[model samples]
Target: MMDANVSDQRLRHQHQGLWLVAGIAGVLLLAAASIAIGAEDLSPGQAWDAVTAFDPADNRHLLVRHLRIPRALAALLVGAALGAAGVVMQALTRNPLADPGLLGVNAGAAAGIAIAIAFFGQAEAGAYVWFGLGGAALSGLAVYLLGGVRQGMNPVRVVLAGSALTVMFLALTHMVTINSEAEVFDQFRHWTVGSLEGRGFAALGAVALPIGAGLLIVAGLARRLDAVALGDDLARSLGSHPGRTWALAAFAVILLAGAATAAAGPITFLGLTAPHAARAIVGTAHRRLLPGAMLLSAGTMIVADMAGRMVARPGEVGVGIMIALIGGPFFIALVRGRRLGHS
Candidate 1:
């Protein structure tokens, strides 16, 4: 018996090590591809040199450093935040379909941006960050209230509440958009279709702290979340406080999801699918699952961005469009096949 247990532990450790190696390799490959493939392609050598050797006169190098690099980083950050948020959300709600977009968080951020443009005369995407964050926080609170979270909400109730809020916020956004001036609508229109283009270090800088803080909160709560995943009674028996875990999870979701939306304009379905993919690869352990999802998501975002550039040539499609094209089918398949209640 002792020998069998030892063998199992060794195999588990080996599997984890293999996943770690593969994850790092995947992120590196995606990052390199993102920097190299665009309107103007760069050879792998050139891309590596652009990062390693600085030259002010080389326009190719400048484009890599100033444009592609920032966009790649933004995609990485946004994907990571969304991926981590998705895992935490599914675990907390016990709903496989629970995601930032499905739960009304992204819609809330979009509504916030509309409000910022219409009421406050905010034009720059960076200027709307706080409003987006505020909206996400409020909408999350509203979902809990509507879902009767305190009354021990189940997965169906939670999703239903989220769906209701999503509709409400989206409707509000449309009304604000239609009533607003043409220019505001034009700006809002571009933002509503999520993209990683036109983002700079400034946008990244704005959301870094919030997203980082959220990740930390999730990490601290990960074990308790594992307990919670087994259900409330078992979690309490294991000395985990479900209420506190839920509150912290909510705050983390707002920070991560809001920051991603504010940075990337409410990209959909990455959160919905990333965690599922991660689970397939890394199983249910949050320690592996969170980072695994991040890498998978970041890689997917990079590939989507690269594909967008390829599919249209000089007239590139947006990353959001590419994600929707891919994720929409995935969503439909999931809905058609999966049982919709608690796991």
Candidate 2:
């Protein structure tokens, strides 16, 4: 019986390993498609040569090398960040429906961007990203305090707090930008809609550190998240600090979701959906669930980005709009179901 049980465990691990590899390959394929299928769509050969050969003499090659590749990479990073953050949020809250956005991070980040563009006269993403990150971190901190996660987590209270904060931040953002110049609002407009249209490698590099740190934090906190999911009392008995975990997870979410929002404007629904979907596939193990969610979310982002490029033909739609359209129905269905009531 012991031998049989060990064999079964090994078999499950092997199967999961295979699934992880397949998931990675799938994301890579989607990313390749994203690079090749933008507004100035490239042939697969051209795409390959753009990366490998890099004929600067060819305008198309320059477009692919400088423009498409950076945008695709940015999408991948943003998606992975949102996905991992979502898993951490849901696990920390014991709510499968819990999204990082529910912490009001998006609103805070948007508000920051608006202020930067309007009051500070910052136009570039790199310039405003710090303001965005600051806002997102503060928002997450406020939510953590208001939700009383350290005292005791109540999903209803946390969601309510997040909702209230979101409204407040959004209203303030509008007020801040109401009298700004046309150009300022124009920049804010494009950002609020969440486009990958013009993001260059610099923006991608700027966000990589925070997102990478956030991922590392989440990856390290996996077992702690699991213990917290079993409830604070049990987690304490198991030698885990539930309160500390809550704080760390919130910070991690701020880092991940904030940097993601910094990179791409608040792309909704990806953060909410990825973890829930990953849970269905990977069970409740935080270790497995976190990475699984990241990969799936990365693939989703690439596909959404590619679809955004195609949906308007010569013109392009923003990735944010595409994600909302795709994830909106799923969100509705999840809400209609019993998941929200309990978690």
Candidate 3:
């Protein structure tokens, strides 16, 4: 019995270490690929030279420095933010299907971008950050309030409230785009599809602090989240305030998911799939799950972005569409396979 227990512990530790290593390696590989491979292919040597010795005279070097670097970095940070938000959201809602988009964060951000384009004449995504944040915050608040912010909230009600709000916001976004000018509609349409094409360091910088702060807050609340994963009464008995913990986690989710969506135009399925994949690899422990999901999501985003670059050659598919193509099926499989009502 003792030997069996010892062996199991050793295997668990080995698995944990392997997962961490694999996650790191996957992220590094994807990052390299994202930077190296684009519309214009360059040799490994050229890519390295571009990174090491940037020269304005060299188009390859300029592409790497001015475009790929920022894009790759944006994908990484945005993926991380969304992954962390997903983990917290699932924990808070006690629903496996719960993602950042469940509370209309994506729609809210889209609506904000539409408003910015139509009303404020803001053409750039970086300029939409503030409006997106405001919209996300307000929409999230609306969902929470409508879902019963009072004590002993029901997860089902929250989900229903979010679904309704998502529809409403999406409708509003559609109406705004339809009535807006052709130029504004074109820009908004592309932005809503979610692409890393034109995004740069400035776009990433706009949301970096918020995402970072949200990650820190979520990290601190991991244990509490675990407690909340149990029944609310049990969590309270274990000295975790379920309501407070959920509220904090929800706020963090808004910050992280909102920033990611605002920065990159709502990359879906990453938040939904990343946490579940992390749970499969690292088990339910948020300590490992959070970072694991972050790495996985970052890699997934990079892969999707790379695929978008390759599939159409010069034309390129949007990362959002690529993810939808991948995630829509995964979502269906999950629904068909799992019992999501009582996660």
Candidate 4:
């Protein structure tokens, strides 16, 4: 029995290692493809040369360094953040359909941007990041407080509170937009769709610390999350502190989702679909699922961004719009196939 148990553990470890290797390889391949394929069309050799040398005097090198590199990094980070956050939320809530957006994080960020634009007249990318992060943190805290009633933070209550908060904040944002001038709407409209265009390394710099810290926290809490998944009472028996676990998970989600939302506007469905897909592929081990989900999310976003660039000819469909277009139907199908409430 001891030998068999050891063998089983070894097998699981091997399986997880395989998934990690595949995920990292996939991310590298997607990153290379993202840099090589774009509207301006640089050959693989040229792109490699441009990236390696990165000479400002050469237009190709300059564009690759200043534009494509930053945009690709942003997409990769945003995707990873969304993916990790999704996995954490699902584990925390034990709800298969839970997503950061479902908890009003995205809407809160949007409302923050709208308020910033309406009052402060600061539309800069750097400024938007701060506003978005503040909004996400505040909204997430509100949802947690409201959800943590009665016995504790019930998943259903959290979802309900998030849905209600999202609606309220969205309504407020709409009202503000409606009352404002066309110019303001025009500015907000672009942000609402979400894109990585015209953004610099500065945007990435602002989010690096928070995202790094969040991913580290998520990594440390992986075993705790796994324990929590065995049901609250069982997890408690196993020595897991459910409240502390939930609090850490919540903080990670806010850090990740907030940073992503601040960098790009509220991207949809990546969070929901990535973890679900990862689970389907690799089973429910949080250690495997978390990293797998992150890679898959990054790959999905890079592919979506590439498709968006190609589909519209000279014009591009921002990543946010593309995700909504793809994720909406996927989400509907998922909801129909599974009784999410019961699950």
Among all candidates shown, the one with the greatest TM-score? 3
Q: Evaluate all candidate structures by whole-model CA lDDT and list the values in order.
A: 0.83, 0.86, 0.86, 0.84
Q: Residues 7-104, candidate 3, lDDT per residue (tens digit)?
A: 99889968987988988988987898788898998878898999888888999898998889889998998889999998988888887877998888
List, in order, the clash count of every candidate structure: 0, 0, 0, 0
Candidate 2 lDDT over 190-266, as tens digits, reads 99998887788878887889999999999999999889988888999999987788778888999999889977898
- In model 4, which range of ten residues has the least summed lDDT? 334-343
lDDT of 1 by residue, 64-153 (tens): 988789889888888889999999888987778778765678889889989999999987766777778778877888887777767875
- Indicate the residue-level lDDT of 244 in model 1: 82
lDDT for 236 in candidate 2 is 94
Model 4 backbone overlap count: 0
CA RMSD, predictions in order? 2.6, 2.4, 1.9, 2.5
What RMSD value applies to candidate 3? 1.9
TM-score of each: 0.90, 0.92, 0.94, 0.91
